[model samples]
Target chain A: MKMLINVPESVVPDALRGMAAAHPELAVDPDSRLVVRGDAPVAGKVALVSGGGSGHEPLHGGFVGRGMLDAACPGEIFTSPVPDQMARAAAAVDSGEGVLFVVKNYTGDVLNFDMAAELAEDEGLRVAKVLVQDDVAVTDSTFTAGRRGTGATLFVEKIAGALAEEGAPLERVEAVARQVSEASRSFGAALSPCTTPAKGSPTFDLPAGELELGIGIHGEPGRERRPMMTSGEIADFAVDAVLEDLRPDAPVLALVNGMGATPLIELYGFCAEVHRVLAERRVPVARTLVGNYVTSLDMAGASVTLCQADEELLRLWDAPVATPGLRWGL
Target chain B: MKMLINVPESVVPDALRGMAAAHPELAVDPDSRLVVRGDAPVAGKVALVSGGGSGHEPLHGGFVGRGMLDAACPGEIFTSPVPDQMARAAAAVDSGEGVLFVVKNYTGDVLNFDMAAELAEDEGLRVAKVLVQDDVAVTDSTFTAGRRGTGATLFVEKIAGALAEEGAPLERVEAVARQVSEASRSFGAALSPCTTPAKGSPTFDLPAGELELGIGIHGEPGRERRPMMTSGEIADFAVDAVLEDLRPDAPVLALVNGMGATPLIELYGFCAEVHRVLAERRVPVARTLVGNYVTSLDMAGASVTLCQADEELLRLWDAPVATPGLRWGL
Candidate 1:
């Protein structure tokens, strides 16, 4: 595969080293695979720590900074980080207030974060946990025993991180995180499968002229595969899947996220169709974000995440955030 | 052509419409194909107007907002925007203070921007132009009579726009734009070719297991295609090409930009290799940005742009600017 990497084994550590160089503001620990805010352990502030496998970049690690996660623990490509990494990050970033672990719904992630929470608690640190299972596409998937978390990981980090940054109590921060998680849902469709550095080939066979609807971020089998569809059709299906699962009465925060390799031009074009679909469905969108925020490695597709936002959630989302992936109002 | 688009003909307008919908802070005019700052025509401040072909998203259009371009004009995919679009954007954003046009070095862009300057001048608006010819790949290639302007367009717009935002005169803004262009040099490599919406096929053939070095952004022939090299080798080659001519006397601002379809993980790993090369060459980097900033549709590769920065350029780069693509500091 013609991918940009020295060797498959060195991908995560090399990238962490690069991240440290590019963003000196983050305290990157390549050995422990932890990326912590430069000024971590902010006095009395609830520290947010979230992470998952590598490959889906700018998700957990790229979201660590002033108004987001206090630390992140990235695992190998498409593999869960062990409990030791998470426990080390929690210890590094936790202030007197407490630590909150934002774990996605994959079985590996949930289990590891669970063990990490216990490990931190055993050390006299108060740790709260919230699992993000916002993907409406599947009830169970290849790596997940429940609905896999997708785009709402961003929503959870931003909204809840805002509360945490405000020096909210750990329980309150945990509540807000769970609240955002319950209010969000995501669906993804893939135009192409991605290749892992280790595998050096596409994860699966997705022949030309066909698209996978409801595909998981890890290229897990989706609801179905059909002949290639236009952007409008895909948006309609993805949005429909999300809205059907979450018949929201409140206005929504929309995320039209690129699955790694989709260009911005197409994302914007697809976003317009999403807006059209939402308008027809009478859902007022409070805020919209479009980009490769949470991504699979080089997969050419997009995921739609919608959070039914209350005034409080909107205010939280609008707060200043200074992460490498999502920066605004700072 | 498994791409995310409606009808190929609707790509530009659709994306523009989506841009408007997504960024309410920017006034996007679909009819005129312009993205203007929501608060335009700021009196007594020089304005920056930039535009080019449509496929490169977040370039000219995404750069339109506070502390950046006052407006951007987007043309059809892989095609130059006409004089009318640029002239209209110039007129729409120009206050009595005047407007500066930032044009890339492609022949159509330079020629049409020249015509647009005359049109705007005839309309009683002071117009100045700066052509970015930063690519060291070739002296002249498929779409240009000089080195193809690739990544340095971002540096010019950002540095010069910061100066303009500080109420600098049009001539001064124009001068620094030229200064930035002169100080900057870029080199690119491609693993695969991109497919345009209208063409519905790969722009050019790039056989598997090979790569083209010193590639122009539009899939133009580079120096040569060789069997694929590792990321370290590519970084060595790309940085060598840039620093060979730059030979910086001051610390440099480095932009390790992905040519669409390369993931952030790989970009960061590639960035580490880039840093290693620069460190060994003893070229100090003042700042580094890693992402898909300037892109070639969905081509898989990257470009390295290095600008030797003095204190003034570094200050301008650090200033607060809010835009869809690049947002930070206030």
Candidate 2:
């Protein structure tokens, strides 16, 4: 598989230990695989929690810090975290304000977070759920029961986390999370399939000279496989898919994210084309992020995410955030 | 080759445009291929200038901003920048105090930067050079005449930039840069070869089950090709190579850097093993960074860099610096 790992089954635990060693500000629970801020459960503030599979790194775990997720529950690669982990994280991080569960809309994730929320409520803790399903790639594929959540999960976490930090009520934070999800749209293209550690082979076969348009995070079947296209063409495909889902005449926050194994140089070129296309369509852009944020193990691809940003969302995004994966203004 | 690029020749320029678009705080000169802080050439402070091939994202370009390099001259992919570009950057960033050139010890880079420094001197600009050759992988490899410079370039730029920001003289900054370069050492391994854009093929070939120990950043031959080893064994190989060169009894700064294609999850696990080995050796670690800081384009491997950190270097590292790729304490 050409992967740098120990035993396949121990990847998650070993990485968690490494993460704890790297970032002293984060407190990792080896028992539950939950990563929370050292000073978590801020008094009188809403606690934001999110989680998903482990392969898409820096997603839920690396985002746990100031002005972002308060706690994150991580599952095995491409598998949903169990309810016990989420329940424990929720119970640990819930101050008086309450806790909000920001979940991506995949069948396993939704069901697991639901179960955890119920478990937390049974413990007399206030809880709310915000589902992110912004991928325009497909409605049902692989593990997804509906449109799978992709890059917009970052937007929901950042914007909603900012509101939570400001001591916003649980209901208000959930509303903003939903707003970000609705306003954002994402589309991805894969140049190569990723090999999971246990499998030791590619999840799917993609012959050379062909590209998968609108591919899902887990190598799910996309819109179609076509001859390799130019960077401009690929950027147009992703931006057009997003624009079709939601035409943004107002200023938007755009993220040109890499699907693991893609270099930053290519991501920058793709991002330039995306902005050019958006400008040609007369869509204003308030902020832009170009790098690998959400990834699928070592897949070689890129995803474009656009979220229609209002004043409040922009302000929240501009607020100070200090995390291992995403840090700025702090 | 599966890369997201338009034309092979346009990769550098297109990516520069994208970087300029993504980061408005830095000014990118399309003609000279220079990325510098928007408000550069601060009066009374020594200016820092560094550059190299383009594929190593966030190394030279992304490190340009507050408390780092004043300007970075980017060359073509895996090709050194011309003397003209370096000369232009040196002239532009000289704030009358002086400009210090931080050159990685590749033959092409050293020759080109030397010519540029002479040109800058003819223009009556005070300049000093600090060459980084901290890689213990090979004394002479493809494109390099001596020890190939790798991760320590980051430490030199960061620590020296911090000193310059404090209004230190040119000689003092140069001395500190040399100290950092001398104190740091690195070793690398690659699971797969990187395919250059122009070549449109892998730089080298390795069977699926084998690995290259101490591979160069540009796919140069390393110590040997051997059977794939476990992560713990690989970590030991790297740490042992570095420790052989310099044994540190004091607190040291450690960096576990991924070479483009490696996933962060693996990096964390690998980083954990590196720290464990260091702890076993009774090395006190004051700081650690784990990510793709210096990379070969989409190469699946990693490198370990350790620098003996004194109080001055630690203080400088902890100072607030804001840049596109590396940002903290802002």
Candidate 3:
């Protein structure tokens, strides 16, 4: 692997140490693999906690800060965190209000977060759970039992975190989180496969002139593999798949996300094509984000996600958010 | 070349269109290839203008917003913009306080910006220039007559832009820009070559299991090529090179920047090693940034930049700035 890591086993801990050092506002516990806001568990506010694997960074850990996730429990690369980590994080971030678990739709993540929630309840902590299954890529990929949660995890965290920052009750926050997840859909394409450090080789082989459509973030088999196509054609395919599962009447917030190794310029190009396709269908875009918000290790690809947005959700998304990965309106 | 672009020729304009659409706060002029603050020409503040090739997204264009460059003129990918674009940008953004040009050290860039400054002077606009030559990679590269400006261009624009935002005179702003350039040094590595869109192939050849150290941002040959080394050894080499040119007595602002295709997880791992080496040397880190701020398109590698920071520079760095690429303290 050409990755810049000390050792495959130590990548997560070392990265966490660096993250903690970079952002003083974050309190990172390497022992437990939990990242939380230094001033978390704010009184009378619902706390948001989310996590998955380590490879898709800036997702759960980088989103832990003011007006976003209150805490995150990161696992090893492409592996779900254990229940102990989640339970500890919940206990740490749960104020009198409650704690909301933003679990992605992978089997391991769902099981672990469920166990953690039960443990937290046993400890007299109010816990609510929202499962995000926004990916339209496949239903039951390698590590997932249902449609895999992808970019909408970020949307749910930002919107629900905004509602929580308003001192909303736990049920209200959970409802908003569910609403965001239900309103969203994502589809990804990969021109190249990413190598997992431990694996020491690419998870899959992508010949130089071929591409995979609807690939999962963990290098799971996609809907189809075809000879490489132009970016415009690929954008059309991804956007069409996402739009198929989306409601056309409501204006949407679009996220053109890079799956790791794609450059920003390419993302911008893909985003422009996405907007063009949406415009042709007369879909009003409420907001648009283009970057590597969610990613597979170093896969060269992009994903298109569309979330039907209402004024409330838009307000929540536009609300001040200060995190290491996504920061705006502070 | 595997890239997500529409047409090679239209990449610059198409990317700019997407940028303007994504960020309504910035004014984008496709006709002149300029990105400026939506509400520019602030009555009394010095206007900051910087630009170069278009491939470096968020460097010049994405940095055009509050507390950064008032205007950016992007040319074709990895090609210096013509004088007309810069002249028009300067005239558009210049307020009564005058304008300052932040030019990177490349023959084409310096010559074009100099011509543009002369043209602006003919129009009765006060202007000053600061040339950045902070890349410790090589004293001269293929496209540059001296040490090529790389990551430090961002530092110069940010710190100098902060001074200009505070209504500093043009000469003072230029002085600070030069100071930042002088105090900073950068070195990069590339595991693979970047293909220019027009070229339709990799800029250079690199055999598998090898890496280029001290590479220029534009795919220029580095100081040496060697077998691929572990991330720790690479970090040591890059940090040592940067520190050789950087004074250890002062607290330094460190930037571990990815060259487009490097993943955030790997960047964090590399950053951790950088901090470890700096700590061993007892070099205090005043501030640190880890991300793809400056990039070579789709190149899978990273660069390390260190700027010796004084109180003024730190204050400017800490000041609130809201641009699409870098946003914090706002």
Candidate 4:
């Protein structure tokens, strides 16, 4: 419950100013609330755009740059970005080709991004969107919406952005992005609840010595709760579920993501267990990444994402990408 | 302090397995404790390598991919990786084009990596290194070893990796990486100490209302301890110090990195204040990135990194690079 801040309201804006001062390659459109790469309208390439709640830093906005997203809209802490922000982001990053929107499977995000896309389309801009529903913890389609997109969204942006930079058309980019979504699967578990800056206390109650499996990124309840297990056991259940859902025969890409609050040491512990489980199952892991790629707001949990990699996927994966959040090969 | 684990000793190995399962593009040589890109020995490009304590996930290890580092050596949690691991990483990724070792300014990391480079040289391998010393908060390099490189190391790896991927010789990569190290500056503030899984307690003491500024990534005490301030005021002080150190007139690349446990909302708040301060100084804010790039265990802190960039640095920033931790335009 300890924090260093002047006031709760100033957290977001203060961070934005710090970012603008620190990174010169990215421009902050204060009025629009968008963080964009300087030369965003990159000629003929299809621009990729995404945004959501603000508590998860670098998820959407930080990934805006050369090889990845052209622009990202940061919403209020844990709240979806309004349609105006998304609409402007889509428009600013749009080049001659078109723009692609990568949306997580959350009601607020879906509704808002969908509205923004419609507005962009009305503006004579071509915008296509691929909804990411990679989370496997939820299964009720009648009462609630579909599974919430968790970790796989990172892979979607990564591959889709690479293809966009390669001058792939919007349709092709959307198709591959969707394929990644279809092939990817993710599940998460939480050990503690996180407090929203505005709220100042935890959103939920998670007693010590317990873990919530199948949790959502928003601090929502998971499918089950049990006594806390070692990182090895947690990795077993999470990676097993993802592997079962992905069912990959060839080598696969692994995205072991921390859902905020989990230490890097523990994440490595999770990764170690996952590798052992996969090895035991004879699953060929083509590559591996362990970090807080997609995170919640200090929600002491982690998620696992498995993407079945093909030659095309690997090529796209290897393609050059530059964004405020991720930059390499220039 | 609360944590979930089985045996503390197995944390790092378990995490590595999980990372391998989650990211298939990275291949883990468990025996050697080296994580290399699946396509390592990248045919004809100089290999780039980095590493340090295990707590900073996605740093030295997570950044192994196409456009970034060719290999990353992960040490035990908060402990530097041994020399053999770095030697193995250098050997596995070197394509006869030499290797550039990018090490942060930590005594353990520098020592182990230096020893490893010597070992590689003893075996007739071409190797060069750049020690990152960007943190301006910890003064008094005259008495102790210089400032501890915390967040700015990412900028060094990223830009230098781009050059190496573009066929820059080992010397050039090392030189440019050093230039980034010298030009960049970073400082951090921690609200709470991180609990090591093994220790099951915090690495340091922090009161409920105060913060430690200029802390290292591995729980090292900062230069000052002060009552917490608004995100804006904190951002101002941090920015002013960095501006004094960097004194950049051109556009800069900004990295507002969360140590861990700090939400994106908090980061944005920091960013907003930073932007305001830079505007006041008439510093043309060029590129801005806000996120949790490098992190401590589960400490609630954030670091600001500024890198002066010109046309060439910007071009290199845009170049295609692939690695597990950072994947972009390929």
RMSD to truth, every model:
0.8, 1.1, 1.3, 4.7
TM-score, ranked from best to worst: 1, 2, 3, 4
Q: Model 2 off-target regions past 4 Å?
A: none
Residue range A181-257, candidate 1, lDDT tens digits = 99999999999999999999999999899999999889899999999999999989999999999988999999999
Query: Each model's TM-score, in the order given?
Result: 0.99, 0.99, 0.98, 0.80
- The docking category that best describes candidate 2 is medium
What DockQ does each prediction reach against the true complex?
A: 0.82, 0.77, 0.67, 0.44
Pick out the ten consecutive residues of candidate 4 chain A with the lowest summed lDDT: A138-147
Number of the top DockQ candidate: 1
Model 3 lDDT per residue over B1-330, tens place: 567777788888878777876788889877778999998988899999999987777688888888889999998899999998899999999987899999988899999999999999999999999999988978888999889999999999899989999998988998899999999999999988888889979999989889999998889999999999878899889999988888667899999899988889888878888888889888999999989989988888999999999999999998888888988775
Which candidate comes out best when scored by TM-score?
A: 1
Better of 1 and 3 by TM-score: 1
How many residue pairs in model 3 have overlapping backbones?
1
Candidate that beats the other on TM-score, 1 or 4, i.e. the better one: 1
Model 4, span B139-256: residue lDDT tens: 5342138877777788888898888877888888888988888888987888888888778888888987788877877787788898877776777888888888888977888787
Candidate 4 lDDT over residue span A243-310, tens digit each? 76778977888887777777765776677777778888888877676766688877888888889989
lDDT of 1 by residue, B43-73 (tens): 8899999999977778989999888999999
Fnat (0 to 1) per candidate? 0.78, 0.70, 0.56, 0.76
